[model samples]
Target: MSTDAAELTARLIRCPSVTPEEGGALILLSDVLTAGGFECHRVDRNGVPNLFARWGAKGAARTFGFNGHTDVVPPGDLGSWTHPPFSGFVADGMIWGRGATDMKSGVAAFTAAVLDFVAATPPDGAIILTITGDEEGPGRDGTRAILDWMDQNGERMDVCIVGEPTNPEVFGEMIKIGRRGSMSLNFVAHGVQGHVAYPHRARNPLHALVRLLDQLTGAPLDQGSEHFDPSGLQITTIDCGNPASNVIPETARAVVNIRFNDLHSPDSLFHDIRAKADLVQAETGVSIEITSNISGESFLTAPGPFVDMVAEVVAEQTNRRPVLSTSGGTSDARFIKNHCPVVEFGLVGRFMHQVDERVPVEEIHALKRVYGGMLEKFFS
Candidate 1:
């Protein structure tokens, strides 16, 4: 019993399931999984589409889970593509389309692997698939919705794997054990507006904001942690919206994004920034207001049995020992980490969310074999 992963990937690519749109991708997967003897459920919440499919009993003693998103970033500049973004065109031994490497291929591979695995040797345990359609968007209603539904419905998974593109350059080269915490801080400094020539009449809010930003970026947050690089603070934007050189603006606004490691939490970082803003305000008399939103906190699935098993399978199949890294941006694994130990592995991501996104035909098939091997090792 074998599944053609490339063919399945092509079919998925043709679905046009961009962020927040089902585009028939979930419907197609439901039909296939149901045919393969799995129970399927549509866990739609707040108008976002999610699918939960399981094989075996509701709560088996040992259950393996796979998480992935079918939604893709919008394809930019259609004319720039050799083939239509949704064409799923295969040429020169590659499947060319949007979501090819970003991860329709990965979903296809695991789906194929699990379907074939059960048909051939039915594992003693259970398998669960949580596929979401809102990863590329605001993500308020995608996998989170499915997990909420799962908790309410008494569904559980022992360990989970997120099928996100973790490899940067080649198949089996990298696996994400964790991701850095992410947050954005928005600052607004208010002062009296006046003519630039009257230095005493107007307090320049821009000056105070610049000083605050300078303080924030003056030092490294920390030396690189054990599994992660040093925390990064990047000032994404600074604006006063003032056009007149002679007039000082009343308010200046800026935003800084931080990718932090386990050394810091959102509270600690916010407190530190608050202290800095307080000092700047005292020195300059400009009222400073700071607000922050946290995307996720840093997490690591420490080296253990499940992690070793996944690494061993990839090494044996691809002859490449994957580096267990936590160097990438956030993913849905951040949400899954709260439920169970979660890690990310999938196709090389060099071309994801780019023009002419694609994946090699052979790589898709190889990924299926790797996923199938993981299933065998897990249940053995």
Candidate 2:
């Protein structure tokens, strides 16, 4: 029996596979793929569930892969949803449930397309699927773990398509060619604690921290790059949790998040932030410490055969030329970029992560047709 994308999507949404929870979604997919003659593996790590499946011989000369997550973000304020978040209800010609658009539907579309494609054409190369349950959580052990295992086991894909919900408005309207990098910086300023009444004796750390933040946000990181907007720095938090107005606090902390393009690196940005801290220390005589965490660096898969082919298929299916874009927060695509050239395409995503999240029923089948077309063209 051939799989229908919409029905598979409904089954997936009913799992309530919230981040870091297997919720039985991967098991269902594994069963489906196994019956279709694919070698499937449960790549579980750190209590998180992931699936890697392949059809065709190992190390085939040409391989195509799809990467996605079955996990959905938590459904907040359950009473606020029109339909139960996990009901998988079909109403008004839409599939209403969590993960409906953010991407359980995307996974279903590609899986259905692959099942039909291999049975019909039996491509000359290989088809691989990597689905994870930890994408909406810490994400350290999802796709990254699968890639590590693939390296050890000698599995590789020449090109990959991340089934992230890429279209902002309508289906087939956009494809992500690259993504900006992300980093978080934390600052702590030390001061001498004393009574507020003694102005000359007490040093205020808040004053120094404010000066440091001003310097960091004083100007734009850079002018817009060829394929990206200018890097952005936003102060996310400032803490000086002293309740007593009479006493000055000994430490003040602040945090800033930076979204950057190819023009900068984590080290380069860290160096600049430390320089500002040093200047503040010299002027205020207040000791300051800076620390940072780099999530993922910016990456781009330049328009080429793989990208052109995906775009061509999208345009033909929807009758609208898709725009190559790089606007969005980071995704698993960041990790996949290290393995091979990668791009992101899927259904319209206006409802992702929102209460009553949904995808139009027609769009689900339309997406399957587009994915099926790409598979046919890639193998021919």
Candidate 3:
């Protein structure tokens, strides 16, 4: 009998695995995988849960891998749902829950497919599944920790697929070949405080901050790049605590976030922005302090045999030619990319993270067949 992916999804949805909290999700998966003849390891670190399971040799010549996360974002104001957020309610032929679409369904489908694949026609190569509980959290230790452990244990994948929701409108409309880089810069402008009547006594930092912000947002970062849209920059927040209209605040704060393409790197973007800040400070005589954090760098799995094969499989299954896109925010694929060639494809993501998030039962089954086809093509 084929593994029931929809039922597995419902069972997983019943697990309350919110970020950094296992909620029995990984354990449930471990039980199923271990029983299916795969080696399972709990690579939990720093209070975050992770699972690594493999079938076949440790260092096989040809290894196909899959990555996904079970942790769901918190269900905000639970009263708005048609069914309880964690009820795993199956009605109208759709599974309703917080992670039903964002990814519990994808995980269930792939897990079912892998189990059936190995049970029927064990591949000549190995298969690895990396599931993390920290994807929706800070993500410092989820997949990264598993990868670190794999390095020490001498385990690696030749190519990996991250089952993030890739289709925006339909089940196989898109595949992620690359993702744009993301970073944020925080700026604090310092000036002397003084009375409003004495304009010359204080260097107004807010003036310099406004100018710096205007300078940064005045022009486009770039027109566009191959396989990516132009870089985007947004001033997310600005603050000055002074309540009195007559008082000149001593400090002004602003935060800017940039989502960039391959044409730029964090260092390059920071240098250019800092120069603008320096120039503004020199002209305005206000000290500006800038600090930055690079979340993930842009990367691409160039169109080749692996990409072509995945696309062909998707087109074959859904009868829709998928577009190779790099427009989404980011995923664990960013981490996996550092280890091996990685790409992302999964269910339609129209309802992910929204109230009453769900996936069609048929789509879940279809995703299994697609993943099964991937296994067949890879091992043949």
Using lDDT as the measure, the top candidate is 3
Query: Distance from true position, residue 319, model 3, in Å?
Result: 0.5
Error of 1 at 310 (Å): 0.8
The lDDT of each candidate is 0.93, 0.93, 0.94
Question: How well is each residue in 209-248 modelled by candidate 2, as lDDT tens digits?
Answer: 9999998899999997898989999999999899998998
- lDDT tens string, model 1, 233-267? 99999999999989999999999999999999999
Can you tell me which runs of candidate 1 are displaced by over 4 Å?
A: none
Q: Answer with 2 or 3, whichever has the higher lDDT.
A: 3
Residue 299's lDDT within candidate 3 is: 93
Q: Which stretches of candidate 2 lie over 4 Å from their true place?
A: none
Query: Where does candidate 2 clash, by residue pair?
Result: none
Rank the models by lDDT, top first: 3, 1, 2
For candidate 2, what is the TM-score? 0.98
